[model samples]
Target: MTDEGDLIAGRYRLQTRVGQGGMGIVWRATDEQLGRVVAVKQMLLHPGSDEAVTEQAVQRATREARVAARLKHPHAITVYDVVRHGGKPCLVMEFLSSRSLAAVLAEQGWLPASNVALIARQISGALAAAHEHGIVHRDVKPGNILISRDNTAKIVDFGISRATGEATVTDAGAIVGTPAFLAPEVARGGDANFASDVFSLGATLFAALEGHSPFGEVDAAIVLLARVARGQIAPPKTTGPVTDVVLAMLRNDPAARPSMRQVHEACTAIVEGRTPELPALGRPTLVLPARRPRKRVVVAGSAGVCLLATGVVIGMSLAADPTTIPEVVSPPTSATAATTVASHGCTASYRVTDAWPGGYQAEVTVAGERGRRLVGWSVTWRLPEGHTIDDLWNGVLTRTGRHVKVSGADWNAVVPAAESVAFGFVGGVADGQPVEPKLTCRTP
Candidate 1:
């Protein structure tokens, strides 16, 4: 609705449009009061959308401004103010003169696995802050991820994000995200959760590395259904840690993935010169409308017997199956736990918090000379289905289906000998139910 030299909200002069999207149009404008160039986003108000939806959108925008204004991370775009332009809403944000992930993909083809991991971690860190404040960003795609002129990653687009459990404004919800990045649950007509945001993060990273979605389609509903019912996944050709990390995050089983903190660590590990091992997708929590009835395949040459928890039965290792995944074994769990070993008057401990949807947590703590001579150490665990690797901290690493591993700085990079170094890992689980931590670590 704005044109060249249009004065917006009586104070900002509109210039050329810097960007536009499903939610709104972003224009480069001049602040008459400050006489500086700025970016203003005029939000769309659809006729079909109701008052509740519009209110929800405004509330969400306010919440996003609250976070974006205070967030100083280089990977996040800055927000300056909120105003109503011509009876509609307008958001003023920092003008980065940046290229989007979609543009980068188009111009550069697929990026290096490490680069994708780097970007994912950056976004995840921002999301972690948002999630801690009960926010869920429903739309996370390549276009929403902006890379500044200096090439720093910036996460944009919180128009659809709402505080967790808040009623949303968009009834147009045929799944509110781009098809390639929509989470299965949201695509299946359910409320988007923090875990769902994690799923979208995984999808964005997947497209960044694979030249396509891990599921291989931009079809929204079909992709959601596939994520809910099917077990088809594979990494792209330009993969290593990238393949591992993306597959782990794009898991169909939510319980099988690491927590946001874990995902952060895994991604950071990639940057820090470490590879993460993926985990098995966890068991299904919410039954899909069309899950193929589980069949009892005979176990062949198995050293350990197949086990099932919560009355769920499994016949064989899913490692051999192409179209299906094996069920998860959830033993009686603890909400919080830490595993540590004491040696030479030094102790290294890893503690976990808020394990849910088949995810585990760890807040590694160190004491004594152990932290002084930290050598390379690795943390390994399973990533269940329905969940994706969201974040990992301390170091970047690789991720695959159900297995995840990480290496850290204090753990062998900086410490000369056996030093106790602290780190942590967290992820979104598939079950939507919180689980207890039960880690059994030993020397190999």
Candidate 2:
């Protein structure tokens, strides 16, 4: 029902339909109040669709605004605000004078290695910023990269992106993202992470340089996905010196891929005609499942992006060990309450889990706020006087006098966005009253 000249929220006036995707339609609009041009993306809902579908669409639009707002980079699109019109949410974004890189490639066939390196450099820098904030841009295809006439590239369409530890918004058991650019692990039904983004970006650049999918083109989506799942990449003939970096990204193993930061540095090196310094490939952290047919599936248009609908539940269990800290049972009411405190956009809660004649076990849970991620964390507190620390798990423990410090372990170092990681310890308590020590958390 939206058309040109239609006013939204008495501020933005729609002027033209610019683009349409599986999730929404984008428009070129004028901000009458601010007297500037802006892009407005309205959620797409089929006519006569049920209420639940419409609600999901609205949530997706709102989430796009929130997730994109957390990232600030020159080569990334900026989200201005989320406005509602006709009972649906619309995302107001910075307007760019450009066309999609996909469109550019379709017209020009392919670009030179130097030009592709420049574009990749810009996109990698923006993606590096997103990763630093604990955000994974699941879809990094050419359709998501906009190229201006002047060759300035901006990465857009974070509608399907997710933060570390954040809950999945879609239904259960759904795998989203364009099949052509999906990393082998994702195509093999593994979860997408920071490394997945690296693979997708590499696939994007490979497509731009090769003028076709690195996995080869196919008529059916399933067929292309099957090829992607096999993890065999066609070598690049157009890209000369850039070939090594591109192939490094297309490695079958996710962990074997260099990080976006390293990719950016390598791209910068390629542009400068210097020898790129990349790290040795590491072992893949993900194990692909055995091949099998999937029941539920969804595929988008030619330039379709993917979505997911799965949740990960984190839990811990400990056995009774007299020498080590055991699980919390029944503690005194006064010591049962958890003390919650916030630090560096993360929340830490301390609670006592078990108490014996002269010893007690306690745990501290550190959770990152929505859209925030913690690479590593350290919690510090002053233990009761005359108390000696005995044991700890899920983190490294150190004591200096009455002060105790616990840092995350290799297995549980990163606290995903909207996710929590915990560490527990047992210590000898003072003879008198059971006093809880205040917890302070720091993240980097």
Candidate 3:
């Protein structure tokens, strides 16, 4: 066992143990040479394992680490380096102070619809980026999505990911990834592809919105695998706006599912409070009719087509809801008007404009005190745990762990105390209702 304070590669000094999984233990470490914080994940090999099997595991780990290193995106965790310590492969990664989506869901049974959408958008974006490089994330689940304190959703744990056209690592009939989130084909021992990744993502989002897996809450591994193979998904009750997208993604036939790009686009549209143009469902893969009666055989259009139509209706309904309309209060022209003071002479308010499972869209208004004309301004706040900001407008937003800082843009920096400057953002709330962050403002 590697003890605390062990130095690997003669540079990474382990500080403390951060997380542990079946594969390995992760440690918070510092690169003495680079003088920066990093995460070091050491691969775990079972005792008494065969030498050849151990070698294969090491190779697989090395390959996956190399593959993950190639992915460079804001929503994806950055891989810094890979090293070998004590005959085991260790991955050096960018350190992030964050909680997994699984932890968030455990704390809060279900996420708000808008928060779900924001989460899905960021995850889909990461998947799309990975897919563009021919990398398929076989294990796309809540446990792998890290929600930083600043409300940034980053896709992590690419340990099981493989590049397309690569030789299979697992045995021919063995399935990988979490059973609950597996695609039907993958659950049945089919090779994972880009489509399967999409299915898993759909399942992840479904769980986030509905508080359980689409396959329901079966505990037995075999029973869950059977249910996943059967692929009968229950519609999410709480996915208010993005229900159609979720249903379409959960299609039993991988071919019938939308691409990650389409999912990202739909999610982006939902986050921006616009009607998403549903992608055309792909043709279902042909299957031979079974001789014996199966528990459930999913029909293609029954779920996908119907859900697409339902989403259209929901879009229309939302468009017609007067209460959903945004009310952006512009700043006053005069500097002498009375204005409410927030923390440090700045008043701020947050409003949820639209929401769907896994994500939400919100507008934050920050106003200076009356008669105080400001040349430049910065707004800082602490996001609720498990919440992350995906996109924003009218401000430059940066997050460090759970603390978020938003600085006024060139166009909006000069604010008279009589008027307020407001900025909006789309974020994912994992644990509870999106709360107004404790706000502080600085003006110079």
Candidate 4:
């Protein structure tokens, strides 16, 4: 749709059509009086057009009103006003000069660590803000994440959002979200709480880094439901710090999954270079085999750092197998706590999530090779300080003052072909030492 130099609702002068969705059309328009640009969302159907269609359209529009209006977050695209025009509802929102994360991926395969970090952090902030005031963004996907020219991530489309304990646009027991990005809870139609949002965050990051979902191809709802319902088999992301972070977000049990705050911290650590310390937040994490014997296509994890390889670029450490990664990370230094988390000597690039003295986290994702024979994999990193392991998940952990070692086993540690796993740590660090985490992947 073009501007066609048409005035919408007699107030907005349509400049150009930016996007179109299942529900309505989004046009970039100029406020004739204010002389400012705004996004006008005009529903496809009006009330007088058809009773059933109009009712459904109105329900969806009203859903946006309930969530977007109530949630005033910087990461979220702002909704100005919802008015009725031509017997239909029209929504005025802030015009955004950005492209969806999906478009970015389509244009440039997988994104870099820095871009992933920025997007994840901003998305988490949006989710946190929505949760704080009792709202949940039901559909969190690459399409929902819009990146501005300056690279700021803005979450859009609350047309499917749900508020806490409120009536929902969807019928009871109806599934929601794109299958690849759907949280297990939402997939099963059990509950859509803050934890579910965290799960979607993990899926979002996975899609960003690995360029595929754990669920693989999405054909129908029943199949996706079956995949999520099982919640055991995971994708083996190859050659990056993406697997660790995504696995943390895909916990089958909501209680087992880390909170949004913790999830943000872990992802931040990977994004900003801060060492991630996962507090035994009352959940037992799963540990996949480091290297699983698969089809005969060798995925070699070269010793040298992989800046960014175009071809498969599988970095698996499979007992010499590079597919599987260490399930648990040992804390660096012992500040007299059970889990000795260290900031010193931890060298790696990490994104800053919630920065406080000694309170830090890092998230990393890894992947296996596509069409390769990967037996096992492991990720190893040292601590800046001496920290103990309060609790461990998925893999084994070994630690000493100023040093930490994590091993991925073949028995339960092998990352199958074309799959990935996530590992994180939670503990305390010394009050003053600045934490820097370094990531190293190895095979036995």
Q: Model 1 off-target regions past 4 Å?
A: 46-72, 171-174, 218-231, 275-444
Report the lDDT tens digits of candidate 1 across residue range 1-444: 568899887888987866543345678888999888888887765445687867766765676566456555566676888887666777887776766676566445467776787787788888777777777767777667777656577777565567655565543433345545656555445567777777778877866765555454322222223453344444345547656666666666556666566677778777888766446553223222322222111110000010000000111122223244323333235534446655544455654443444564445544444334433445555544554444343343445555665543211223334324344444556676443333322222
Give lDDT tens digits, candidate 4, residues 179-287: 5666655554455678878887777676666555555533222344455544533445454444555666677777777777776666677677776656554322433
Each candidate's TM vs. the true structure? 0.57, 0.64, 0.63, 0.60
TM-score of 1: 0.57
lDDT of 2: 0.70
- What is the Cα-based lDDT of residue 267 in candidate 3? 95
Q: Per-residue lDDT tens digits of candidate 2, residues 127-198?
A: 999999999988788777877778898888777788877865742444567767888777666678899999
| Candidate 2 TM-score, C-alpha based | 0.64
Candidate rank order under TM-score: 2, 3, 4, 1
Candidate 4: regions farther than 4 A off: 1-3, 46-49, 52-56, 218-221, 238-242, 281-444
Q: Residue-pair clashes per candidate, as listed?
A: 84, 5, 22, 84
Q: Which residue segments of model 2 deviate by more than 4 Å?
A: 282-444
Query: Per the 3 Å backbone cut-off, how many clashing residue pairs does candidate 1 have?
Result: 84
lDDT of each: 0.55, 0.70, 0.67, 0.56
Model 3: runs farther than 4 Å from truth?
A: 280-444
lDDT of 1 at 221: 25
Worst 10 residues of 4 by lDDT: 301-310
Weakest ten-residue segment in model 3 by summed lDDT? 304-313
